[model samples]
Target chain A: MTLYASSKAALRVYSESLAQELSSQFPGIRVIIVEPSGFRTEQNVLGYPMQIPRNPDPAYDSVREKSMQLYTSLDGRQRGDPEKAVELIVDIVRREGKSVERLGGGRAESPIYVPLGREANNDLEAKCTKMIQVVQKWKDVTDNLDHDDTNSVDLTRWGALRFFFLGSLHAYRAFQDRIRALASAGF
Target chain B: MTLYASSKAALRVYSESLAQELSSQFPGIRVIIVEPSGFRTEQNVLGYPMQIPRNPDPAYDSVREKSMQLYTSLDGRQRGDPEKAVELIVDIVRREGKSVERLGGGRAESPIYVPLGREANNDLEAKCTKMIQVVQKWKDVTDNLDHDDTNSVDLTRWGALRFFFLGSLHAYRAFQDRIRALASAGF
Candidate 1:
């Protein structure tokens, strides 16, 4: 779960940056970041607990192992439903895309981040605030590292942290087909 | 650089996942992650009077040495420069990108995490926070694992730490690009 969380955080930021680049460089290609929270999926039924490779060093901290174990415990018992999430994504994409140039320049703010469930919204908010807080607390140190003349500091605030709280990349992998199927259905 | 920072982090994650997959699935397109941090660049030309990688294992604390010295001075002055960052990438793409999409939209992002500068923001933050507080303060038992299931222990603060930090993969040498012209572009 340790590597998994960071991996997802990396994904979240990558998605945002990609969104920015794609939006600015190419027109007509819209990207919808569907950030879904936890769901009871086949991953819980099949993947975890035994899948993640263990760090064999005894000197290694045990908290990571415990966390993974805890995550496994919540398997198949998560809150959000994957079927509903896919259904929602299909619905949103279908409704969200609108060709503006053909419609007198009228445009609706497409839902850039489709947070799937209530738990996801809370998690997203929490990650954002904490990311800022961490940066704020470490502002001095982070600031000291840049070139003396450079006026700005680099701070990454990941907005999509919540949807990945469940550490279920495998679960998502297992369900990707289902979502893609739903999406292709008129999406 | 906010986006850059997160981009690298995302890349680190992406690279790891890719490496795992390519090794397991494709068996052809080998993936690698280059996690280099800190060097005597133009900035360090004025900073760090005695560049690191020279702790001869004395006086300096081990943690600081492990974190800074080992990172600060590579066995030799870092061969890669800010400009090589460009030339190196170009050489890679001249060969890396295959078709428009088959090269991989599955390649949403590739994690070639070239962690430049001693100021790897997140890495620094993690080392600092844990080193100071966790070591200076919670040194008693930061190693203990937990299973109490007390609701508030929202884990995942570490999901993104490692895959970004270990930062190494020997796969790059297979194509250590033959570019030298761009490295001297007044960088």
Candidate 2:
């Protein structure tokens, strides 16, 4: 299964854990997590404050309006082409051929110690490498055992709520930092 | 997000619809659905047949013995290597990167008809393709620009009773077919 995440700082961890669980239960399957840079969409815009609604803050209004204008001017070509987006998905299907993953979005790179859009993709790659490595080690230990024998759902296990919350929060904080960086960068 | 379906047939549909929902809401993200062949695992062989004790089928004892033998034999090396599986998954991650619909399994040249495994891998794949193609076409027409969409769910969509009767029956039939295939192949 392959999932495309727009912001690594946004929904990356959520998608990753889900991928792992699916993989464990189903044999001969693969989960693909893709982190793309920001894209201009109906719900989200890069370097822009959401226009839906918020507390009245005159200080932030000017910048918000400017961001909205920039997004609107881009039409549908802000981050990447929408048609290209669809094609990319189809291409993956063609390439993978038989085993396919469900899709979603998150960031492609790190959010730590860098301004918005400045985090290197390699760092995110590193994170993914570590994740898979740890999963490998764990699988080695449990591969021979009956998963259902110990099927008691343990929240402290790798596939638990606490892990999810911690992981998601870390990603969320990283995203917040990125948004702050963008705001500071005069979005 | 990508989902590795427990039963490649039904879960494939679930993952497909999920991919569409995520893609429409979060454009840059991709969803991959991986349909898997059976692995030699406890989950694959446990509690296979349920006899109500007074059942009068002459073939029941033979089937029960066969199920027990399959379970006992599938301890270690006979199982698929988790590392190899992970590598395949990571390979897709690298190739598709951020696109959705990546399918990974052991095979060459994407064929409309893949060969059947004793465990019914080909059947699962065929079923998955049907479900995805159908839903994909449906989405093209009913993107549902207005009301709240009711397509995807985090868990089973069917209620408890219906799920037990229909879903469980479907899974059981698949399991029985697998057993028959494996037995005939002299496994």
Candidate 3:
């Protein structure tokens, strides 16, 4: 499970960088990141129970045993609909496929990302929100770490700083509202 | 440049996970992630000037031209002290080599990540701080995405929640602080 999760995470990071890199050089060509949840695919239809041994070390035995039980229970029981997910992906790609003509006839806007299943959407949304909150919840502790080389804070600039900060914050809020609205609309 | 950056990012992610996986599974094994900045390595002594053309499209020619110029300039002028970096790594590894006995001649603490040069350290620190700020700046917008299925807004739990949140947040802050401090100290 650790290795599997790690691989998925690595792909996520790389896919993001790929999207960024491709954006300017080839605006019409997008590498959409499709986050697929577990679907009832041939590979996931477990034939037999998996063998998960607890760590040999007594210290890690508890976590190992808990993980083993959870993994064992998940075999053949995943709820995602793989076939429907594929159809949706194909539909999206077919729509975006129009953009290939846009390069000369290039550039079209396809959604940057698509979360495949209900479960996947929920997980991704929650994780994104939580991570955002984590940053919000700790902003103060991190914001002041830089050495004060200037030796003085510009008290007069506070008015301008606050205005700029609030303006950016408002724009950010609008963006988030759109994301949530879209997600709730079943995108 | 895009491909190079993407590939390096993926490896960095994979190597970190690998070190974590090995730390628990095989205590005797150690994986070191060496962040080598542009060492005056043999390959970097470019035999010839690199050729980078400005994009043909009139739209992106400016950025392409700028990037081409920057990349062309960095060919062999790297300030990294590679020999000294290697010597430092060797010394660190030697110190950890003694820990193998703790695992019954088994594993040593994975060299948790070693940044190899001053440039590498600067890049890592800047990236980390920026990421944290991004998360913080947009937290409020992301926080309200989910529908409030149960809108009681359990105000009573805020006390405990705040404590737990702060605890986790503090730990996270400490970790970041250590990273920057270590980078500054020439790790």
Cα-based lDDT for every prediction = 0.38, 0.32, 0.42
B77-150 in candidate 2: lDDT tens per residue?
13233333333444444444311122334321121112111122323334334434433432322222111333
Tens digit of lDDT per residue, candidate 1, span A1-187?
3355455557656675565445544545556554444444445322444344566854334544654565565554444444444444444445532222211233423224554443444444454454445444434432332334333222122221221211112122223443455458753
Q: Comparing 1 and 2 by DockQ, which wins?
A: 1
Ranking by TM-score: 3, 1, 2
- Per-residue lDDT of model 1, residues B75-182, tens digit only: 224332333333333333443422222224454233332232333434444533532331222112211212223432232343422322211110111011211222
Better of 1 and 3 by DockQ: 1
Worst 10 residues of 2 chain B by lDDT: B108-117
State the lDDT of candidate 3 residue by residue for A80-116, as single tens digits.
Answer: 4444444444445565442233212335443245544
C-alpha RMSD over true interface residues, each candidate: 19.0, 20.8, 17.2
**Runs in model 3 lying further than 4 Å from the true structure:** A1-10, A13-19, A22-68, A72-187, B45-68, B96-111, B138-187
- Native-structure RMSD, model 1: 24.3
True contacts kept of each: 0.05, 0.00, 0.02
- Binned by DockQ into CAPRI classes (incorrect, acceptable, medium, high), candidate 3 is incorrect
Give candidate 1 misplaced runs (Cα > 4 Å). A45-51, A59-69, A96-111, A134-187, B1-7, B11-187
Q: lDDT of model 3 at residue B120?
A: 38
Worst 10-residue stretch by lDDT in candidate 1 chain A?
A: A162-171
